[model samples]
Target chain A: MGITDETLKRRLDGFRKRMRDKEIDMALLVEPDNQYYVSGFRAISYSRPIICLVYLNSLQFILPELEKDHASQSARTDELYVYHEIACHRGKDTQFHRPLEHLLDRQPASSTIGVEVDTLPAALYCMLHERNFIVKDMGPDLMEMRMKKDQEEIHWIKQAGVLSDLALESSLHHVQPGISELELDSFGDKKLLEAASQQFPDQLIGFADWTCSGITRSFMPHLASSTRKLEKNDVVVHSRQVWVNHYRAENERTFLIGRPSNEQKYCLELAIEAQAQAMQVVKPGVCAKDIDLAAYHVFEKHGYGEHVQHRTGHGLGLTEHEEPYLRFDNELQLEEGMVYTIEPGIYVPGVGGFRHSDTVIVTNNGFESVTQYPRSLEDMIL
Target chain B: MGITDETLKRRLDGFRKRMRDKEIDMALLVEPDNQYYVSGFRAISYSRPIICLVYLNSLQFILPELEKDHASQSARTDELYVYHEIACHRGKDTQFHRPLEHLLDRQPASSTIGVEVDTLPAALYCMLHERNFIVKDMGPDLMEMRMKKDQEEIHWIKQAGVLSDLALESSLHHVQPGISELELDSFGDKKLLEAASQQFPDQLIGFADWTCSGITRSFMPHLASSTRKLEKNDVVVHSRQVWVNHYRAENERTFLIGRPSNEQKYCLELAIEAQAQAMQVVKPGVCAKDIDLAAYHVFEKHGYGEHVQHRTGHGLGLTEHEEPYLRFDNELQLEEGMVYTIEPGIYVPGVGGFRHSDTVIVTNNGFESVTQYPRSLEDMIL
Candidate 1:
């Protein structure tokens, strides 16, 4: 209910417009991100399969009976078909195919359908193909449409950035010589949730602000969390994610407990310089790879090129990671309202990691840094 | 390394045995749960895709470069393939398909391959079949093999149940007039995490204990949480999920803020009785649907059949919800070591809701309750 129905309607209309131009008659959206983007129906869909079928003039959200209450509560489009109920499908010995067919039968049956081939389950794809419908990949087009953020989406995403900053700040306040990474994580999350609740009383934002501490585990990027306690000269990575009205953003910083060694200070400042260089040129029409290159160039200039491991960053919105990715393989142009995380890290095996991640929004002539946090080497030294 | 390699090896042998019986030469596991079950490689795979290709003779874990470090550190299987490296695929382009082929090429070139058709992306599925490999659904076989819980899995799941109980208990202590639901949620999570940190300091489990409070919002079963204060005579349904080494379990209880009205007390006791009845019959060789019927029968006897919106409950393991769901259509028999949740909920329009969910495992003769939370109305009433 937080996101306006008008906004959701506009999104659906955008997809339908692309469908018509591509000569596609129907579209089936199965990815939870797409479902949430289109209809505001968000549910834990890791193992369970939920289907959202969209026709030229109608839409049906297919889910299990167990999920009905939640689905009905959140979904903007309310035409729901039960996965367990044969009566809902209204066909002989009904299964997924029957319900899908039943929904399609009421439509014009234009034969051409758009499916999320990139994310939809394989069995469902084969079933539809066997039923003889012309199928096309909706991934490219859907991604293209989703890259540019609307004002409503931007508002939610910016709020997520704010919450992430709150968590990062909380992490900084809690970091000490004897503190366990898990302890900081739980306390930081609680602080973020409390801050978010104070801001939006009616909503709850999802969070994953796990700590990656010490040298070895910190070197291994994407470490969820560890039980290792922070010690003097240890690098504590506080990578945080906060979801506001389903829009998510990433904000992180590397803290040096107590003090930094000469190498640690050099790596920390080098990472900040790399992040700044990437942020400086993040304007409309700039190549995504160029931002990544700028970060890599900093490490090379500093003679720490071997320590550089990942791309500068990737995009964020409804999901933590999305389009407009900053990588070497792709040459995609950044556009206004396109948001991405600009995290450039240098992780040395035995010396711990140094990095700071911030959500950045590409504006007309410059970039708007949504995540505002101190990144100087002196400021980050605990 | 959370679960022992010996356990992972046994699990691999189990899957390989199934593959041999089905004559599936190569199995491509893309589901995160399947990957974790086989190789102990756990990652947040809601959006990111990780591939685990199991050959007759060897196993290869394919992941993106960013994920390589953590994947290598935890995965028991040694063979690792980097998706970005052209050397790994040995072709012009290095995409997801090429590395998949690189692994498949090492095998005896069997025409038939097993893939998780139920969960694998549609485009990947079509591409494999188009490449002339007769792709068959491994979902059924994999599920059958996963239905019976191993000792390692059960141990982790039991720990999750314990954390849930701790969290629920913590929530009970904080529930009082003027206390907001979000605050209780944060406090409860902190308590659970603090306890976990002390026991398994190296691990930080994922959590999402959604709350449905008040009258109208509580009527909407999928309500995540609100900042609304827990006033006197309010109904609060706390549905929690705690993860232990990626194995998940649910332990939920509907609580009264101050005291329940006559109607509320009647409904609460009815739901508890329904849950108890379902739990009573959860023994080896018992039909799953009959267990669901036990709960539904109770609701019908109390003339609250229409108020009963959902099935008894679903299974829980790697994910919070999985297979062996207790529903009328399903005729699958319960077996020893198979774990599931037994939750029977009743929701009236204006009167609010009542339900208690417990993680239960089918035992040799009877049933074992992994979740040991108090279900009595007086005990839960603040």
Candidate 2:
């Protein structure tokens, strides 16, 4: 969807201010997510090298001619320049490298060009260097801009959360005796497709244990479902969610297939308490590490500190995993309009682990949990 | 699986000979497919930063430590060197910037290092260049070697093909009206997961023609199902086949949700015939373009030339889309042991498109269609 002209202006203005403060002359946005963030356009043809050169006064988009129409309609074009692909026969198309040359010809030399150096291909970088563009680090600055979610972004994420909740409900039905872990993933995946308001790229599916046991937790974001069948007291942890290009919503809950033992119940309670503790203190101005510490302290008080593995949470948006992670070392302060996860878990080697995770948007005073799936200890049952 | 010690030595010797002939001292393999070809390991971390440096006598596998074990298990120890997470991690054992420095420390100054410059990240390239390693283009030479599959690679591809055929067959029964496209994908995906010999990433599941009238041909190669309700004459096209790492055994066929018109029948017939004609000429000592021409001419003769879009086929193995493509421009010679697709399609913009793609391996004499799913027009009934 095209961003409103005012919104585009606002974003560009924001970036301009940040660039001026950092003394970066021009930011060359290459990463798809960053491009989408500043211009509100996702490239239709990514095969041919394409990028947006965003300057304070001028915005230029370079793309193959086949994709020019899509780019023009999607990107706010009143302030942008377009590159069209020539109608060349298939063989001749390989030698077509004039667009980049044309862009360089029009621009000034010796101007410091900020690039998403981390993602730009070596060939493209070489080509740019050959033309004498002074490439500098623009990745971190661009990341900072996208770290905060605006109202519209949060709205979409909340919508995505609703779909995730429905998908979890549908998938839970398939977890019966004899069902393989892989089958549960497929079942959950199918439910996601059925539940989504609309399909997104990558057919994104994140499947993990509902409860970590033995060597299962090592995989972290394991794509394969568990091989072990659900037993009477088997606890499983899983995250069911999707991201439509960066705007993401996920909900994770640990479940017991049947009856649970006292230890399992205790583990689940600790995890819930840990998550609750993070949630209680989640608000604008709080250091992200404080949330991790809050959750860590709760687990430690219960003599399960070592088992509180991983960060309390991580910022979630455009990508399923992003910056401002709620880890012990992170110094990012929680801000209004910031959305991230509050996932805290406890794992015991031979036994199992419990985790409660939800996407939460830091609000003016507190936080709004986007994931509405049932997380109460009473509701989590076979 | 570790390559047989003999096979590893033989491949290494072959690479050395090729490098010498090309006047290159060393070629760096970073593309996962190329890395898997040289070393028998395929990484589950598809987009993660990992680079494998292969020299005349030794191979250095540099990656995030989480992947060291996977890479080591895939390649031989005699030729392996590893750089782990310690060098890369910056804080909380999470953020990392060290392994990259470690990689640069090992690079020999003034040595000719061949890199797949097209895929290498710009930042990494700059870092390597700053360390004084001269980088050169190695993709063309490596791609030439991979155009033809070896005996063992062909064997695994055929095995993957058989499993894919079964997956398609079992999933056909689940296609019906009122079923969401995601449900169809899930059913087929479940079968694939159950029958998986090895995990393949981004296996094709072209359901509706999402490109044109949103029916068959448009949603191709790597599309997941959506919540779109299946209906009469939807012309569902699913190639939810498994890819065994770089080796793929993909089989795609269109289905008539209900009764299909004569136009639809002709489209499917023309596509199947085109694929047949292309298959007839498949063998060693032929150029890839000839195979493409065979199919192109047939469709042209049938007055459906304009309808046939995209390349006639593409090489398979290592990457789902590989070199030696069956396109008008491809002049690469077909050799025995080369494996690729011979898919020919006919797309009518507003109605639907039809394609019949099969994994074909160039035999010593002719060719063998690895995907043996029934392709008779009569067998395509819903």
Candidate 3:
């Protein structure tokens, strides 16, 4: 968690450039990840509204009265405001409307505000509209700014990757025939967590919950753990995840309960090969979607094209999924300092599901696998 | 675990009663807890938008195509709409703007719609307003309805209580002289999770993360677990939480390590007495604020009034903190079936913080404590 004020300053400078291009005088940020990116402060905004107003040269955080102490401890911003101290009717401040208006009044009255419309509540939007402030969506400019990872973010992601590997190794050790998917998941979760206190000791980095889907249940990409016990030839799809101060990394694998059937082997090998082939072309100046095409072409050549379910991969950073999603038609180009998960999956109803994912970072020359956990079929046999 | 259609039916009927009283033709639910309370469906809506539309006699669910199978399994509604097709950009649907408009088109264009305006994003609200629908806030109507806990929900809360006690007991055993706060949190976390698969073999209940805030850190109630190791006179505030399906419950304790100073013992006793006094008045027909006053009176009598930080407690159910926040100015009356935490605290930064919380349901005569984890000063000594 080596987040520094300098890093926050760098991100703020990037936002200012984007704001200048978008002609937004001020930004009303509500998204947790977005706020964390602009300011070093990150607190819960799920139960209540916590906003950050970003001007070209200043950062202001507005939060509930209860969280004032937390903001003071974590927020790098100097200007802070709390609601409920102002006008209230029945001791309830509805929508933080008055507080938001009061903050907006501090700036130029006609400031063109850039709001995260996708996440900000509509009632709050109406309040801003009622005040006659020109509003615009903080879309491409904001998303593009977050697309590239910083050295600090990459460092956290790498640390998370180490934890991910530990979790995966624990899952590999527990994938027995009689064990339930949930039982195996707990083994991995506890295994890594048990090591955390001994290793990091004081660090509060959190282990993301994970699950394994045994048998045909593995065909579903995001299957929850089941009470169903693993059987021989069952394809067990399991994943390990960890977040170091909100920067996350994932290492997913498709393992066999016992000996793999020929069909299962075929699916697993193709997935592995497809991932290898897809990643071979990953580097700066590459189209994000073309990376997906590389994997799809492999599946199609093997006559299991319809079995491809999700995209080749998704960008990974502070949030689990970020911009430059490796979907088929995304025209965004991959850039250096961008980190992504390169996963190619194929699922057949009766046979089984096969997929392997690794976290990789685009480098100056090529791509570096940050989470290089083994994805080989023979190595994954339980 | 025995969630059934009857539970959903009962909740829907209750919503119908409120909708009729409020003259709202239909309701759009977005808050995860609110949607889960009404429909059996519970899926991630973090990165994507998943909406629930409740009409007079029907329930409709709209979600991303990736969650179609999940919606089918968990949602009681038959009118499910998935945005994207199995393919990529060719079938990609942007926001639910079109899907929402289509759903609204089935009703009167000017139909009066009740919305969770506090949580609904501004972008989605604009779509509804743009469609010429009469929009109204579902605040008072919704909060009042959710305030009361159903028997099934109460059952889940009680079950969560059992797990909480287990976690507290484990933490009590692990609070040694030199263990770091995070190390202690992990000890309890692992101990509880280690037994999850065996006890509830079919359940996928996830535990909410908790930590031990040792010594001076305890004064900051929500302080993240640090590297600080336990000392002879440290006061450790630790909480345990479990979510059964979507219902959540918490049990928190302030433990005295090895030995306690006179100040520590005094603060601990005052906090315990304050909570006892607060719960003594928690019955039907009592003002929510009065319960807070009961605690305040004790703290004031003890000359520790300024030490009190947050509200006495908040209503608990699907989410951690809910309606009927026990603040000094809240005028809402307590009613039977309303469940809440009764926690009173004294935080002296230089010394330590002391707080004990219990989840209880208002009964006909008074209240019954659901989370009866031992918070006695003698039992807390490690």
TM-score of each: 0.95, 0.81, 0.93
Question: lDDT of each prediction vs. the true structure?
Answer: 0.79, 0.67, 0.77
Compose the digit string of candidate 2's lDDT tens values, residues A1-382.
3356777788889888877776767777777778877887765332445678888787777654434445656676444343321112343333225655666666687766777887777877776688787777778877787788877787678767776777677767676655545555566666666665245432322222232322344233322243444455567776676654336887887877677777778888888988998899888898988888888888888888756545677787876667777877677888998888988877665557688789999889998888888887777766
Angstrom error of the Cα, residue B277, model 3: value is 1.5
Report, in order, each candidate's fnat: 0.50, 0.25, 0.33
Model 1 chain B is weakest, by summed lDDT over 10 consecutive residues, at B85-94
Supply the global lDDT for candidate 2. 0.67
For model 3, residues B14-101, the per-residue Cα lDDT tens digits are: 8898888878899999987788778877775545678999999889988875566667777888598767422433555644567887
Mind giving the per-residue lDDT tens digits that candidate 1 earns over A1-382? 3668888888889889999998888788888888888877877654446788877777778776556777776787648876652112224322456667676665554388799888888877776777677898887887888889999888988888888888888878877777677778877788887787678777757877777888887787687665567788787778888888778888888888776778888888899999999898899989998898888888887778767766788888887788887876558988899999999888887788888999998988989988898888888888
Worst 10 residues of 3 chain A by lDDT: A85-94
- Measured by DockQ, the strongest candidate is 1
- Candidate 3 residues lying further than 4 Å off, grouped into runs, are A83-98, A223-233, B85-98, B104-107, B226-232
Query: Candidate 2: DockQ?
Result: 0.27
TM accuracy, model 1: 0.95
Indicate whether candidate 1 or candidate 3 has the larger TM-score.
Answer: 1
Error of 3 at B78 (Å): 1.9
Q: Tens digits of per-residue lDDT for model 3 on A36-141? A: 8887777754456789989877888877765666778778887877654211223645345666777776767777999888888787788788778889999556
